[model samples]
Target: MPPNPDLRQTIDVAPGLDLAATLGPLRLGVSDPCWRVEASGPWWWATRTPAGPLTVHLVPGAGVVGVEAWGEGVEWLPRHLGRLLGLDADGPPAARTELVRALAQRVPGFRVAGHGRVADAAIDGICRRGVSAFEAARSWLLMVEAMGDDAPGPGGLRLPPAPRRVASCDPYELHVMGLEQGRADEVRRVASHASRLEAGTHDGGAEAIAHLAGIAGIGTDAVEHARAVALGDPDAVPVLDAHRTAAVVRALWTGAGADDTVDVRSLLEPHRPERGLLVRLIALVEAADAADDDGGLTP
Candidate 1:
């Protein structure tokens, strides 16, 4: 049968943009339960909006990101397309320092993609706390598989459970999914207040972070990560892990050690609002180098 009719829209974008580089950070993995990316092709994302479940497929062409969506929230994706792709970001402010300039050159077209929903970002942030990226991704995939619903597409995808659904989950069940009791509780707390959190996505996320930080297990780092990923707060810097800290130190400060108490903000002062984007680019460059050294293996 021909593909079922679906609500769709195409958005023309600037030429030379790497859709993958712009959107890849949002995908947890190739087999991520919430999103799927066809190698060098389209990106499919599944989520539960306030209206209902939705699946959006993003395809990049000569100068556009084509969007095909299905389900009750089809219009929601297009409504926030600009924010999702960072179309409004005024590229990096003129790079002042040599380090910032070089780093910018290394990762061109790298945009900070936003989730457009504070609840989604908050849940991802909660899962990522005090864990390796691999572990965090695993927890996310497992939790979604256990709690999410089948997506409304041909890709055999799944939509993450609505916050209300997750909020109502039994802690013991979540514990079985490898979430410790504390983290599970944190997830529930955020989910229970998901509506309030969703409203906080506006105003650049200061309100969202403040609201979430009040909950146990959600800290400054988690709040920052959520703000950057969900609210598109250009200045939000994610809490870095040991390896990332070392990488930043080596890349920016020639002889600085990881324990040198480096003032990260000062290093990127010239790039104030774009600091988060700059940081992600540096991390991308580091990841690329490591991949090359490991014979193109990727984590």
Candidate 2:
């Protein structure tokens, strides 16, 4: 055979862009089946797309992010690659404040990555709302394993359930998996409207986020979470769970955690359009500090 060539697209990135910091957020956990970053370097993802399931490989260099893929989703994958890696929006709006300057120095080359697959993003984000990280991860895995199709081009990877698969599920069945009754109902509703949600990604900006208001069960947290990944808002903040909120709070006030999105938004106001990106950078730093066994003193 010669060569098959659906793959197309390259993203010019800053030198030393930390792929791990960028893409780590996509996985539900280190064991998440949707994605992997090899110890040697390359990143791989088994993702759902508007066209279908795709297995994507990303190779990073000094100023470019190379792309390769195989499966039904190939045609649609290239179009959304930029948003997939959270490169859709421009970076910080210029570091004019002291805090901005400090964060810049503290977390150089930090980039937040999100898989801009609308319906899929909505599923993951909605699953995570109002739950413990552990519970959320388990819930997500349960749903995927139970309803998702076998991915076409990768080993040990499962596609996120298609809208039809999810929409057809009985809400009670989902509840048994981990979601509460309300959230389970929300999942079904979202699945029923997956196509519309997917279309919103194309709408972009406030209009897209605004469309979520019509959804009954999707609350502010879920909408914001969906916005982060679906819209590829680099500044998309997803205080993943209370731990993240605690970390952000600890970094700011050196005390207990605060679950107030309003206050957190206020605290991060100076970062402006980059607030979402800023949180990711801080979370990365906090995780690193935790790895050092210093109890993660800073975010």
lDDT of each: 0.73, 0.70
User: Would you give me the overall lDDT of model 1?
Assistant: 0.73
TM-score of each: 0.86, 0.85
Candidate 1 residue spans exceeding 4 A from truth:
2-5, 92-97, 199-210, 213-217, 256-271, 291-299
Deviation in Å, model 2, residue 88 alpha carbon:
3.1
Q: Taking the tens digit of each residue's C-alpha lDDT, what string does model 1 give over 133-159?
A: 677778888888877889887767898
Residue 32's lDDT within candidate 1 is 76
Q: TM-score for candidate 2, please give it.
A: 0.85
1-299 per-residue lDDT for model 2 (tens digits)? 52343574678877777677778777776756777777767788887766877888888887888887878889877666766665654553255566556776665666555576656677777777777788888888888888887766544477887679789988888989888888888788778877666533445635646666588777676677777766657566763677777666666653355445436676777677777766776777778867678664522
Per model, state how many residue pairs clash.
0, 3
Candidate 2 regions with alpha-carbon error over 4 angstroms:
1-11, 90-93, 199-202, 205-208, 254-263, 294-299
Candidate 2: clashing pairs of residues: 235-276, 235-277, 236-276
